[model samples]
Target: MGRWVLVAVAPAELVLIALLAAGVEVPAGVRATLGLLMIAVLLVEAGRWSRGYRRGRRRGLGRRAAATVAAAELVPPPVTTALRWEARVWTGLVRGLGRRPDIPPGAAAFTHHRAMRAVRWTFVGVLVVEVAAVHLLVPAGALRVTLLLVGLYSLVWVVGYVLGAGPVRPHLVTADRVVLRCGLTTRIEVPLAALADARPVRRSRDRTASRQLAGRTLHLVDNGGTSLDLDLRSAVTVPLPRGRSAEVDALRVWVDDAQAMARQVRAAAGIGPGAPAELPPGR
Candidate 1:
């Protein structure tokens, strides 16, 4: 029922918004009716979501997992996940200003930002130039305003992406687990006991996806390449966007210092010879 309402009303709402943005006047009665209908839909969906959320919690799911399940009950999981990703990007911009990595005590941080810094900044520069050009060349009117707004929003997204790939997210190796991250959206955690091997390898590809899964292997690429490969003792669950997950037996990741990272992981996990006696503190 909620899905039907959303499917029916969402397009109309979008059309209304676009009309308003384009300076096309809409009747007050029509606008008010649409508004009330939208509000009713939201209220109904909210109630449904609350009930679903409680049921999920009662089933022993974590807070985030429960919320995601509840949201999926109201709308498609991908839509909810996309909305959350956008929110993360916006918040990441503010968090990036602090220039602090999400490192914890007794964990070692391995950063991959350097590999993509130049590319990210270059893209951002291009966006700025494009925005400026559009603003100057476009005439004053609804179209111009819409284009300008879109350009500005694109600029913000790029900036957020840059930040998300940098200090806001970094790979961490704790005493018992290895936490691999790409930007603010993707995270994969593998227990030390599950690590079979760690090696330094360079694998470059012509793809723009930050995260990719092929068969039982997951790739977390930066700057179009990966530098380290991890082999797990058994398949472990890796979470993907839109409430999807994969049973991964191996992982390929990009980091600024792949050799060092490999060494640290092997040492901590007692995988190779001359393993360290104790885990090092966060860097």
Candidate 2:
């Protein structure tokens, strides 16, 4: 946190110092724009943190089971185990059959690809600043390429939108025991047993019941020193899960089964849920 604070503050401080040292009057509009931009980013981040992804949240019965187990310390380990099994099976069934896009665990994995709108707006801002700045700094015809840049930027957004909804092609490769598959460059792969720890986070969003539905996230780690914090909801987006509803359910079941197996393997390997081994202790 301290490092991040310094990182953010240092750049602005240096930029301000340089401008003042050079005797260039700092423009009010630039300062205001930068301040507003930082505020907007901070607000968006706060909103996301408050409304976490929902893939990690267990289903209704699973939630009950968790509560039940948590409420009573008198409950034996065997009872707890049974509750976990039941919850896992029930949640697996629901997730498989819901036909929703499975989200990947990492925050970056989920938001980066899907945020083309934000990127588009950013490009627009850049183009506006560039054109304005160029017009002021250079004589006519020197900024002749502004129109070309505008067209190119416009084309980028159109192409991104078209591809964003279309069928995605995955490029898969193997790196040692891990398989790497890229869907918009999101990768997920690790040996079945090498997964040393797993942690699940539940999120939901509801508006009418004064509730909000959030998504789930699973943080994972492997013994081979690979780790990923993924949101399952983000990972599962696309092509409506081919075939009939049953097929979709089957896919979901398969995914849940894989999750459970990975969790079990982590437990057996003495890995806890949540933090991956490779990550630093306080993260």
Clashes of 2: 40
Best by TM-score: 1
Candidate 1: give the clashing pairs: none
Best by lDDT: 1
Compared with the true structure, all predictions reach lDDT values of 0.84, 0.37
lDDT of 1 at 184: 70
Backbone clash count for every predicted candidate, in the order shown: 0, 40
What would the per-residue lDDT of candidate 2 be over residues 65-117, giving only the tens digit for each residue? 54444343333445555565454444433443453323433211121122234
Off by over 4 Å in 1: 7-24, 46-72, 206-208, 240-243, 274-283
Model 2, runs deviating above 4 Å: 1-120, 128-143, 146-188, 201-283
Residue 114, candidate 1: alpha-carbon lDDT: 89
TM-score of each: 0.79, 0.22
Tens-digit lDDT track for model 1 on 1-283? 6767876798899889998878899999999999999999988888898999999999999999999898877876556666778988877787787776568899999988986688778989999999999989998888888899889998998788688768778899999999998877777889998887788899996887878888878899887889998988777998875578989888999998999999889888888655323322320
